[model samples]
Target chain A: MAPPEVHHLFHHPIADHSFSADRGTLAVARENNVELYGKTGGKFQLKDELRGHDKTVTGVDIAPNSGKIVTCSQDRNAYVWEPSPQGWKPTLVLLRINRAATCVRWAPSETKFAVGSGARLIPVCYFEEEDNWWVSKHLKKPIRSTITTVAWHPNSVLLAAGSTDGHARVFSSFIKGVDARPEPSPWGERLPFNTVCGEYLNNTAGWVHSVAFSPSGDALAFAAHDSTVTVVYPSAADQPPKAVLSISTQVLPFMSLIWSSESEIIAAGYDCEAYRLQGSEQGWQLAGSLEAAKGRPGLQDQREESALNMFRQMDLKGKSSDDTKLKTVHQNTISTIRSYEESGGVVKKLSTTGVDGRAVIWTL
Target chain B: MAAVNWRTINIDALDPDSPANFDLTSLAPAVAPVSTADVQSLAGHIRQLLRGGDSEGALRGALENPPYGADERGKDVHLATIIEILQSIRQSEMSPILSRIYQSDGGTEALDVLMKYVYKGMGHSSSATATKQITPQATGFSQVHGRGGSEGGGQAMSVLLSWHEKLVEIAGPGCIVRTMSDRRVV
Candidate 1:
C-alpha cells in the first residue's frame, strides 16, 4: 500500500476535522478558530479561517452533498457556514445551550444537524424557512452528562451519542417537517424526537469517547475511555439487543471511531493509530491497525563511533539514550478520525488528526 | 553489589553530622544522582511494561521508585515523566492496580505523590492557572464549579481531575480525597 499522507499543520492539538463532498476542502478545529484548507497539488494549502468563537472550537463538520460547514465551540455556540459569492458566510444556530458544545455532525439529509454539548443535551437543529434561521429542539430527558460524540444514521433520523456518563444512546431526531417518515428498522418505527431507541453502556462503564452507526444502520459501535470498543445490535424497539459484544483492548483509550463497512470499523485515539475491528452478529474482534508504524529509520546505521553524540544527548536530554522519535506516524494522541474516501459503500481511506497537530490520511 | 555498597556508603556520608568520619580512600560522592535521562529511561521502561499488559511490573516500577517523591526532582525532570506514566494507565485496568497500591504498605504516600504530579502536569497544560487549587485544605467538589462529578471526556485537565476521583474511589474516603484532612506531603 502507498504511504499515508501526513500534513503537519501546526504545533497545537486538533479537536476535530471534516472534509467536503469532493474532498477538495478540509476544515479543522484548532484552538479557538476553524481553519479551512484546500487540496492543491499533493498538499493541503491554507484557504481561509473562520474565527468567531471566543472559547476553544471543539468540533467542525462539512455536509457531503450540501457542502455546508457546521462548527461548535466551548463558547456555547454553533455556527453554520455557507459558501457564498464572497466567502463562507456564517449563520448562527440557536442551540440555546449553556455549556460548551463538544461535538457536531450534520445529518445524512443535510437538512439538519446534531450538536452534543456539556449542557447534557443534544440539540437537534434544522433550518426554519419561516424564521430564516436554524432552530434547535433539545433532547434533554435521559442524558445526565456531557455528550462527547454524536453519530447520525444513514436514514438521517436516528442520532447516536456517547457521553461522559458511560452510556451510548440512540435518540430519534425526527422532525415533523424536515424529515420524511423513516422506514421501520431494528431501532423502532414511529420514531419521535428524543425517543430513546436504545441505550447501551460500555462493559467497563468507561466514559464513551465515540459512537458510530453501521453502514446499514442496523448495528452501533462505541469506544470508551476504558480502552474497550462495544458493538450493539438492537433486536426491536422494546426487546433486548440481539447481541452486545464488547472487546477490551490492551492499548490506550480510543477517542474516535468510524464504520468502514457493515462489518468493519476504524477507531483512533490515544493509541495514535487507526485500528480496525471486524465482526457480525455472532461476535466482533479487533482485526489490527490500518497501517503498522514503520518505526523511525537510522537505527542500524548508528556506527558513527562518536562518544560526542551520546555525551551531547546526555548533557542536553539528561539520558544516555539515542532513540529520538516515536514509533508512530502521529507523534501524539489522535483526537478525531473521519472517513476520507469511499468506494462502493465501503470506506477506502481515512483521515486522522491528533494532538500532535498532524492530519494523516491512510488508505485501506 | 559492590557498586550498591559504594552508593550506600556515599549516601551515608550525606548525613552532614558524620562527614568528618568518612573514609578518605572512599572518594564516592554523597547521594548517587540519577540523571534526568536515567529517570526518563525508567519511565520509558514502565510505559513499555504497561503497554505489554504487565500491570504488576508497571505498578512496581512506578510505586517502587525510591527517588520519585524526592523534593529535589524538578518539574522539568522526573515528576513530568511520572505524570505521563499515570496518564497511560488504562481505565479498565486502573481500579485493580490502584487498589493493589492502596493495599500495599505506604500506598497512600505513593498515590499522593502520583496525584501531585498529575495535578502539576495539568497545571502546566491548562491555561486556567489552577495549579494551586489542590492543597491540603481545598475541598474536592469546589474544583468543579457547579458541574458535578464527571471525568474529563478527553481534555488533559479534566483527565487529571478525573483520576483524582478514581484515586478516591479505590482508596476510599480515607484516600487521596482526604488530602485536606490529612496533609500527608509525599
Candidate 2:
C-alpha cells in the first residue's frame, strides 16, 4: 500500500479534528481555540482561528450538509460556528452541565448535535426556532461516569456514546419538533429522549475511548483502553444482541476508531499508527497496521548523513543519527480519526490528528 | 434504572467460534493486591536499568512490555514501578540519565508515555464509580529517605517537576514545558 499523506501542523496536541463536506476546509482543536485550515494547492494552509474558548478545546466537528462547525471544550462550553463574510461567526450553546465537555459531534441531519461531558451526561442540542437559541436536552439517565466520546448513527436519532464508565450505550435523541419521526430499526420503534436501546461493556471494563456506527447503522463498535475493540450487533430492543464480538490486541489502548465500511474498522492510539480490523457478526480480528514499517533502510551517505551529521543529530537531539526520526508519521499518540470522504457508504479517505500536532490523510 | 435496562450487551458467555475471551484478570493490576511477585521483579529491573544509566532503555522496557501487562492493571504497575524506581535512585544518578533520554530523539514520546502512566495511576476507581477517588499514594508519593538519601522523590508531580528541571538543565528552559504539556495534571 502507498504511504498516507502527512501534514505537520504547529507542534502541539490535537484533541480532535474535522473536515468540511467538500474536503476543502479543516477544523482542529488545538489548546483553547479551534483553528480552521483551508486547502491551498496540494497542502493545507491555516486560514482562520475561532478563538472564544478559554480552556483547552476537546472536540471540534463540521456539519457536512449545513456547513456549520461545533466545538466543545473543558471550560464547560460548546459553540456552533457559522461561515459568514467576516470569517466564521461563533454562537455559544447552552449545555447545562457543570463539568468539562469532553466531545461534540454534529448529527447527520445537521439540525442537531451531541456533546459528551465529564458530568456523566450527553446533551443533545438543537436550535429552538421560537427562542432563536441553541438548547440542549440532557441524556442523563444511566451514565455513571464521564462520557468520553459519542457518535451519531446514520439516522441521526440513534446516538452512540462511549464513556469512562466502560459502557458503550445507544440512546435515542428524538426531539418532538426538531426532528421528524425516525424510521424504526433494530434500536427501537417508539424512541424518546434518553431511551437507551443497548449498552455494552468490554470484558476488561476499560474506559471506552471511541465508538462508531456502521454505515448501515446495524452494528456498533467501540475501542476501549484495554486494547480491544468490541462489535455489537443488535437483534431487537428486547432480545439479546445477535452477537457481541470482542477482539483483543497486544498493542496499546486505542484512543479513536472509525468504520470504513460494514465490516472494516480502522483504529489507532498510543501505538502511534493505525490498524485495520475486519470482521462480521461471526468474528473480527486485527488485519494489520495501516502504517507498516518498511525494510531497514539503506544508510544515507550524504554529507548530512556522515559522522559529523551523527554528532549534529546527537548534539541537537541526544541520539544516534538513525533513531532520531520515528518510523511513523505521527511522533506521539493519535487522539482522533474521522472519515474524511465517503461514497456509497464506504469511507474512501481517512484523517487522523495526533498529540504531536500532525494531521494526516489516508486513502484506502 | 428501568429506563436504561435495555443495555444488556455484556458478553459473559462466549461463542465457541469467536476468539478466546480476553483475560481481564491479567490486566486488573492497580486494583490487584500489591503482593504480586511480578511487580517486585519489574520494579527491580527498572531500577537496575536506571542506575546503569540506561534511562531510555529503562523507559522503553517499561513502555514496551510494562510488566503489569498493557491495560488498567498495567497502568497501575507502570505508575508504581516508575515511582519506586524514582524514589530509590539518587538525584545525582537520575539527573544525567534523564537528561540523556530527554536529549534523545523520541524523548518526547517517552515523556508522553510516562505522563500517560501517571494519569492512569492517579485515576478514578474503575470509571463506574460515582466520584474519582484520587488515590493519595498514586497522586503523590512521599519522598522516602530510603537509600542513604540519594534525593527525595518528593511527590508524583514533583518527580515530573524534577524531570522537567533536569531536561532544562541539560538542554535549556524551552526543552521541557513545550515537550510535556501537563494541562490535564492541574
Candidate 3:
C-alpha cells in the first residue's frame, strides 16, 4: 500500500470536511467559520471563507452533483452556499431547531438535506420554490434525546439517525411535492413524513455515535459509545429484524463511521485510527486496523542515544526520553471520515480529519 | 380575541429536559425479586461447588441470578461469594472460563452482573482503606511492629483491580457501561 497523503491545514481542529464531486474543492468546518480550499498546484489552498455562525460550526457537506455546500453550527443555524459569479452566496435555512445543530448531510438527489440537532429532533429541509426560501418539516416523534449523526439512504427518502438515547432510528423523510414515491423495500411501502420505519436499541443501551446505510440501502449499521458496532437487517416494515449482529472491540468508542460497500464499514474515533469491520447479515467481525505497521520515531531516537546524550537530555529537560509524539499517523481523535474516491459502489480511498488539524487520504 | 403570537412563545421551554420527562425505573428489566433466604441458599450452593473443585460451576452459579431486587445486605452476601470464587481461580484459567461463559446463553447479562459486583467490590475496598487511614493512628502503636494487615488489604485491592481489567478484556467496555447505566441494583 502507498503511504497516506497528509495535509496539515492549520492548528485548530477540523470538526468536519467534505470534498466536491470532482474532488477539486474541500469545505471544512473550522471553529466559527467554514473554509473553502481549492486544489492549487497539487495542494489545497484557502480560496474563501463563509462566516455567519456565532458558535462552533459542527458539520459541512457538499452535494455531489449540484456542488452546493451545506453547513450547520452550534448557533442553531444552517446555511446553503451556492456558487455564483461574484462569490459563494449563503442562504439561511429555516431549521426551526432551538438547540445546536450537530450534523448535516445532503441527499443523493440534492433536492433536500437532513440536519441532526441537539433539540431532540431532525428538520428535513427542502427548497420552497414559491416561497423563495428553504423550509423544513420536523421529525419529532419518538426521538428522546439529541441526535448525534444522520445518514441518507440511496433512495433519498429513508433517513437513518443515531441519537444519545441509545437508539438508531430510520424515519421516512418523504416530502409531498419534493420527492418521488420511492420503490417499496424492506423498510416500508407507504412512506409518510416522520414514519418511523425501524427503531433499534443497542444491546447495552449505550449512546449511539454514528450510523450509516449500505450502498443498496437495505442494511443499517451504527456505532455506539460501548465500543460496539451493530448491524441490522430489517426483514420488513414492522416485523422483527432478520438479524442483529453486534461486533464488540476492545478499543475506544467510535465517533464516526462510513460504509465502504455493502458488507464493509470503516469507523474511527477516540482511538485516532480507522478500523475495518467486514461481514454480512449472518455475522460481523473486526477485520483489523487500517493503519500500517510502522516503526516509532521515538524508537529510532532511543536506538541512536548514548550515555552522554542521556545525561545531556536529563540536564536539559530532566527526562530521559521524549515521548510527546504518538505512534499512529493521527495524533488526536479522528472526528470525521469521508469517502474520498469511489467507483462501482466500492470506496477506493478515504479522507479523514482529526482534532490534530490534519486531513489524511488513505488508499484501500 | 387577539391573534396569538406563536413566534415569541419559546417552543423549547415547553419540552425541556426535566426530571419529570424521564422515568428511570421504566428502564429496568422485569424479573422476579429475590429474597434473603434465596440469596443465602444460592451462596451455600456456590460454596459447595467451589469446595468440589468446580470453580467454573461456582462462577456460573454466582452470576446466573444476581440479586437485582434483593436488599443491600443480601446482595453483599452474594457479592462476597463471587469475589471468593474469582480469587480462587488461577490466572491461566481465567480466559478459558470467561470465553466459555461468554458463549453460553444469557452469558452477556451474567457478565454484566459480574461487572457490577466487581465495581462495587472495588468501591468497598477503597472506602475500607479510607476508613483504615482514620483508625490507623489509634492502632499505630500496636501495629508499628507488623504492617501485615494493611499489606493484605492492598493485595486484595490489586486482585479486584486485575479482575476488573480481565472482565473488560473479555466482555468489552459495554459491560461496564451497561452496569453503570442499569438502574437495577445487584
Candidate 4:
C-alpha cells in the first residue's frame, strides 16, 4: 500500500529483543520479563506481560494458531504461556532446565519449539495427547559447546542451529509421509533424515547470535558476535541459494538478522541502527536508527516520575490492572528485524522489540 | 472537707465520662476487624473456652463483649464469623480446618491467623498429664503441622465465612472479606 511505514512503537532500554514469525504479534525476552504486543491500527499496542522468571529472559517466541507464547530465561527455565482474554496470564510453565537458553524458535507449524543452551540445541515437541512435551531425538548430536541461535526452515522440515564455533547445522525430523528414505544408520533409523554440516566461514570465530532463513527457502542468513552477517546459499542448483552476502560493519555486536520477503534485502539490527544489505560488494548501510525521545538523552530524559508513570500518562489501556504503565517487566531496545508474509500476500508486516521497552509494528 | 478541697484547686481531676463536646470517630480506623492476629486470638480464645466445656458461656461472653481482633478497620461480621467459627471447630473436633483456612486465601492471611491460633493454643498444654498444659503436639495432633495434611474439615468453611461476615459488618454491608492470600480480592 504505502511501501510499509516503519514505526518504532517503543524504545525500552535493555539488552535485546527476540521476535516471532507472525509479525502482527511480538514477544520480547528481556532481562527480567517477557512482553507481548499486537498490531492495532498502524501501531503496536502492549498486549501482555508474562512474568515469573527468576532472572532475565533471554529469548521469546509465539506459537502458531493461537497466542501461546514461549520464553526462556537465564534462570534456566523455559515457560510456555497463553495470553488470557482478560490479560497476559501465564498458562503453563513448560520445562525448567538447569541451563540458560540463549535462543528459541517455534516450528513453522507451531506444534513444537526449539531452544539453544550452552553448547547444546534442544528441540522440544509438544505432545497433545500426553499433555506433555519431549526433546526431539534428532538433536542428540551433543555439539559439545555453546549454541547462539536456532531457526526452523519455513517448510517446517529443517531446523538450523548456529553456535559460537561458527558452525550452523541443518537437521530434518522426517515426519511420516515426509523424508521417507530407507534407514541409513546402524539402527535402521535412516539417520532420521537429519544431517550435520559445518563450515569455517571467514571471521566467524565469535558467537553466532542470530540465524534466519530467506522466506523462499533458498538462503540462510546468520550474524555472529564477529560483527558480520553471513548469508549461505545451497551448493546445488535446484532452488539453490546462490551468492554469499557477508557485510561487516562496526556497530554493537550484530544481534539479529532477517531477510525481506523478496529476499532482495537483508536487515541486521545493531545496537543503535538497523543495517540493511543488498549484497556483499554494496556493503551494509543503516536502514533505520532509533532516536531518543526529544527531552532527554537517556531512556526517560524528561522528568517523569518513572517509566511506569510515563506509560500511565500515555493512557495506554490493556486488559489488566493499570496496563497503561510503561514499567514493563522486560525493558530493552530492539536489536532485531523481521517481516510476516500474509496468506493472500496482500499485506507484508514488520514488527520489532528493543531494549527500550517498545514493540513497533510497521506496515509493508 | 470535700467542699474546702475543691476551692483549693483540682484542675487535674476532670470528670472521666462527662459528655464530650467532640466527636471521636476521627480517632478510629475507617473500618474494624482487619487484623489476622486479632481474629485468630479471639477465635483461639473462644475455641479454648468451647473446648473447656464453656461453649454456652463463651458464646454468651462473645455476644456481650464482642472482642474485635487486631484490626480496627473492619466490619462487625468479622467478629460474628470468629465467634461462629470457633463454635463450629470446637464442636466438630476436626483439626484440618486450619489447612482449609490457610489455603482459603491462598494462605496469606489465613496462615497467619492459623499460625497464631495453633501456636498459642498448643503452646502450653500437654495431653499426657493434667498438671502439664496440653500442647497440640503432645495431644498427638500431627496433622496440623505436617506439610500436606493440614486441611481441617468444615472448620475451614467456618473460618472463611466468619471472616467474610466480619468484613461485611465492620466495613459496611458492602465490605468484602478479601483473604490475605489473594491479592485480587477487593
Specify the highest-TM-score model's number.
3
**Chain B vs. true chain B: TM-score per candidate:** 0.53, 0.41, 0.78, 0.24
TM-score of each: 0.66, 0.66, 0.89, 0.48
For candidate 4, lDDT tens digit of each residue in B1-186?
655876666432453321232343322223343466565566567768777976544543443333332343332333444435454544333334433333342232333232233222232222212333323574445443442233333345445445344423332211111111111111
Residues A1-364 of candidate 2: C-alpha lDDT, one tens digit per residue = 5567788898999999999889899889999999999999989999999999999999999888888899999999999999899878889899998789999998888899999998778999999989988999999877767899999998989999998767899999999887889888988898988898998876446778999999899999999876778999999877889999887564677899999999899999988889999989999988988865552121223235677878887998888555655667788999999988788989888999999999998878
Candidate 4 residue-wise lDDT, A237-320, digit = tens = 223234555544334455666666434444444453344555432333334323322322232333436657666756665322
Each model's lDDT comes to: 0.78, 0.76, 0.87, 0.50
Which residue runs of candidate 2 sit more than 4 Å off their true CA positions?
A295-322, B1-186
- Which pairs in model 3 have colliding backbones? none
Per-residue alpha-carbon lDDT of candidate 1 for residues B1-186, written as tens digits (9 for 90 to 100): 655766347543464424244353222113344555666677778779878977566766765663532345533556555656666766676778877876676565566556655655665665334443444554666766422322342366765777777876764432333232222222
Top candidate by DockQ: 3
For each candidate, report its DockQ versus the true two-chain complex.
0.02, 0.04, 0.29, 0.00
**Which prediction has more favorable DockQ, 3 or 4?**
3
- In angstroms, how far off is B15's CA in candidate 1? 60
Please rank every candidate by DockQ, starting with the best: 3, 2, 1, 4
